[model samples]
Target: MSQTAGVKPMAIAGRAVSERERCLGMTDAERAWRKQWLKDQVLASNEPVHVEELWRERTNPIRRFYRAPLDKIFSGLSGVLGAERAATYRYITGKLGLLALGILGIHYYFKYNGNDWTKKGGWRVLKSKPLVLPGQEGFPYKSDRKQPSDYAERGFKKAAI
Candidate 1:
């Protein structure tokens, strides 16, 4: 004799025992849930379509009832970022990229041409009027990089004539 002849299979109330319940061995609560789900699917499919214009018109009160709220919500949530804001951010980022590229070009130019450090020597000073003072002595203007004290330390001195 087989195991089915020895023991009995579980049934869902008055309904036939499902093959799923026999295979996976579901409890009474699970079988009740499965029966309710099947009944819900059958009732949902049996819903009647009641269009008043026979077959010529498809728009009905049931569709518009659900669409109005969805349309309002969609219109309110769409375009969170408008075209103007998107273009503004794009333009700012593009200018930043060009600025960075220009800086890199300057860096490479200085790196290649940095070694030509010879100063083209001549009387390159700007010929201008001397600084007027209380006496005949004139105060010479010096650039920030050059100091007369440095030249004096090198044994070069200017005598007042």
Candidate 2:
């Protein structure tokens, strides 16, 4: 007794259609529900599917410059803050650090920022005083002078194991 002799072959005239197999498996009511679902909101949400120009116009280098360096810095900070695990100690410390920074910024904005300093027109560029060379008193005002000795130490020290 062969398998085809007992049951319908689940194939059309000569070629086997996969859609025919799926239709045969479901009742008419289920087929209508499945068709309605496939035509519903999720499919409609992605209409006119491919928009290459939309992405092309919005690819901004300036915005990426502002975000890129700091994105990695904070991305690592989330791991340092133990955000991956549930711990009361980590949450408390993280929030305390955030609170401290917020308070410090508020203090600076109130104390050094307002009224008497640089009147309502907003923060003016802080005019810097000319720097005088320590040993060269009469050597003229040159900005290209070499830096002092200790700051010029380029020596690399090997780790003491």
Candidate 3:
């Protein structure tokens, strides 16, 4: 008896068939039909399957670095101190401190070693008596002149008397 004949003929009609025959004993035509049926079943299942090649290619080494034990420990330490406070302290104690010190050093160096401001032409120009333009008031040199007071009629005591 033939292998297909001895086995009861599978009902290809609508029936909940749980068991499946292995493709090894199936003829070329039977195998092709089975493949198409399996493909249709998978498409109808509405489940997602990851493509192995794409998944392998997309995995990142940097993600591993972030997940490393030492990195996690350091991140926890910074979190405990508060991220903003830790960052500010790091800046002040690191390059920012050096930059501030360098600026102060430059200012002091110029202050002590540089030419005096009074000796410069700009300072001399500023210090000299301002030139009075036409129709402009000149500096009053009279020390004995008393200023007119609005409070004089208001019963305020006059210091001059």
Candidate 4:
């Protein structure tokens, strides 16, 4: 004759229904009500709560798969190397992993493309030279002759004197 709160105990052929069966038998309205009730409880507690924490089934499967192995590795490292050294190893390994990935990407990119960028004029094939002829205006140099500017003449003339 005992019953739990929020659950309506149903007798099927004079036997009590299991928790999973009771949950499965709930309608859409019941599910929605339960969700709202949980939300209300969270609000009343005034504590930070995630949607995943609210529902056990809402965990990311991919994250879960990677987490176990990573946790094991981290714990093993911590035990062997101590916490500080373990953190350093994690940081170094992460950077090395990223570098390796970058190197592999660059290797594949160059292998597939092979001088196609130069062919497409993305880069110069030869060293560039000044387009102007010697006699033309806007030429590069006047024979590298250092002509004294007005400021240099004024400053240096007095200094030399």
**Estimated TM-score for each candidate:** 0.25, 0.23, 0.22, 0.32
- The residue ranges of model 4 lying beyond 4 angstroms of the native Cα positions read 1-71, 115-161
Best by lDDT: 4
lDDT of each: 0.54, 0.56, 0.55, 0.58
Query: Higher TM-score: candidate 1 or 2?
Result: 1
Superior by lDDT: candidate 1 or candidate 4: 4
Candidate with the larger lDDT of 2 and 4 = 4
- Writing each residue's lDDT as its tens digit, candidate 4 over 1-161 gives 34556688764322113466655577777667666655655544535544755554756778567555555687688988997788787767767877999999887776655443224423222334457777788776343325645322322434533
List the candidate numbers ranked by lDDT, top first: 4, 2, 3, 1
Judge candidate 3 against the unseen true structure and give its global Cα lDDT, from 0 to 1.
Answer: 0.55
Q: What is the lDDT of candidate 1?
A: 0.54
| lDDT of candidate model 4 versus the reference | 0.58
Tens-digit lDDT string for candidate 1 (47-84): 56646477336567786675555445444544664645
Clashing pairs in 3: none
On TM-score, the stronger of 1 and 4 is 4
How many clashes does the backbone of model 4 have? 0
lDDT of 1 at 59: 61
Candidate 2 achieves a global lDDT of 0.56
- What would the per-residue lDDT of candidate 2 be over residues 2-119, giving only the tens digit for each residue? 8698887763322212467675587677667666655553655546575858855766978657555544555567677663442444456567877999999978886676443225
In model 4, pairs of residues that clash are none
